[model samples]
Target: MAAGTGGRGRRWVTAASPVLLPVASAGLVLTLWWGAVVAFDIPRILLPGPAEVVSELIRLRHRLWEQGLVTLTETVVGFGITTVAGLLLGSAIAASRIVDQATTPWLVAFNAVPKVALAPMLVVWLNLGMQPRIAMVVLVSFFPVVLATSAGLRSTPVELVELARSWDASRWRTFAKVRFPYALPQIFMGLKIAMPLALIGAVVGEFAGGNTGLAFVIRTASAGGNTALAFAAIVVLSLMGIGLFYAVVALERLLLPWVRAVTA
Candidate 1:
């Protein structure tokens, strides 16, 4: 019985290690940060300690929430648009050699252009407010989705396609039933890559010209010489990005349970 109990305890520890390890790592980093600040006697204005940043977080929680919401909206909306458009365009490109030949070069060229340089142009075209920000998110994130979708669809197994054709499956039926499902993993991989980019795009838009969002908060805080507040805003943005990325992961797991099972 004691041996069985020991085994169970070890299993429990192993099971919980994933969560515990990240928490411990984060704590260690924060401890190091705090110690460095204390040892160096860093000025609160130049490099506030972690405690100061946490205090700023609590003090300005409401303002952060409001700004964070704006950023979240821009990311979600832009990502959603990119997802739909990318899937459609990717499907088209995958389905037709002519479409692929005609569009691939243009898509590559557009993606190669510096996204940051386009932020100002987007602002000029869309005008101030969330429009440019959303556009920025879409622009920054669109390529990955399109590229992933096309690649995933094209990567669908030839054997599977032949089997479906032998079964007299219609093109749409084969795509819907076989190709799309098989491609979901790659497509989701792209989405995970794009999620952070979407947030960056939103922040870049805010940086270019905006009075709201976390980027704006950071800018204003730094301009006012409130380094702690700037750090706080940055922390919030990092957490938001992490949360959003995991949300996509959760979605992928939900939709592609088989992929996980196969990998496992």
Candidate 2:
């Protein structure tokens, strides 16, 4: 009984310990923000208080929800493309030394060009709809996935590979049973990195060219100098990013339960 109770207590402490510092820090920042608003006599147009922002959020709920959905769709589509292409490309490159070497310079050149500069060209080619936005998100995100997957594939234990060789495992069987599983943690690491970049890319693409989404609302509100509305849209966009990040974390938990146990 005592051992069980102790284990439960330890588990609680282990979870809460990590959360406490960040939560306390956030509280401190919010308190400072409230104080600064009063101390500086900040104008609403210049800097809305947290309460005002919350109120604006409530007021704009419907519009925010609609725009948020559009942004989410773009994020999902873009992230899907990035993951699929990255994995395939990573596998192909990892499986072939010649291909990896031949493509390295071209890949470097592609990554070198600023994505924003190409956003205009994307809009011209794919039009101003979801295609351009998805393309931009994929462009911003896939590099990390490719790099991480390649690294992970290379990280396979030589002993394990030799064991598979001794068993006369086919190349596809070896990859499926050993290399891909070994790469999953790194792949998730890449996903965590890609998620926010995808969100930002979607928003940037929308801002540059799209007729729909939170970015459009932000642009319109800013142009009208409706600072509160613009600020409200910005806040909604931030929340969307947060929600997407947590969604990825949740998926990581689900798809990689082994990761959770090991990480824990």
Winning candidate number (lDDT): 1
Candidate 1 lDDT, 1-264, residue by residue in tens:
999999999999999997899899999999999999999998889999999999999999999999999999999999999999999999999999999999999999999998889888888999999999999999999999999999999999999999999999999999999999999999999999999999999999999997999999999999999999999999999999989999999999898888967895
> TM-scores across all candidates?
0.96, 0.90
Q: Model 2: per-residue lDDT, tens digit, 86-193?
A: 999888888999989987678878988899998899999998799999999999998988888888898999999999989999999999999999888998899889
User: What lDDT does the true structure give each of the candidates?
Assistant: 0.95, 0.87
Cα deviation at 219, candidate 2, in Å, is: 1.3
Candidate 1 lDDT (Cα, whole model)? 0.95
Pairs of residues at least 3 apart in sequence or in different chains that clash in candidate 1 = none
Q: Which candidate ranks first by TM-score, i.e. highest?
A: 1
The runs of at least 3 residues in candidate 1 whose Cα sits more than 4 Å from the true structure, single-residue gaps closed, are none
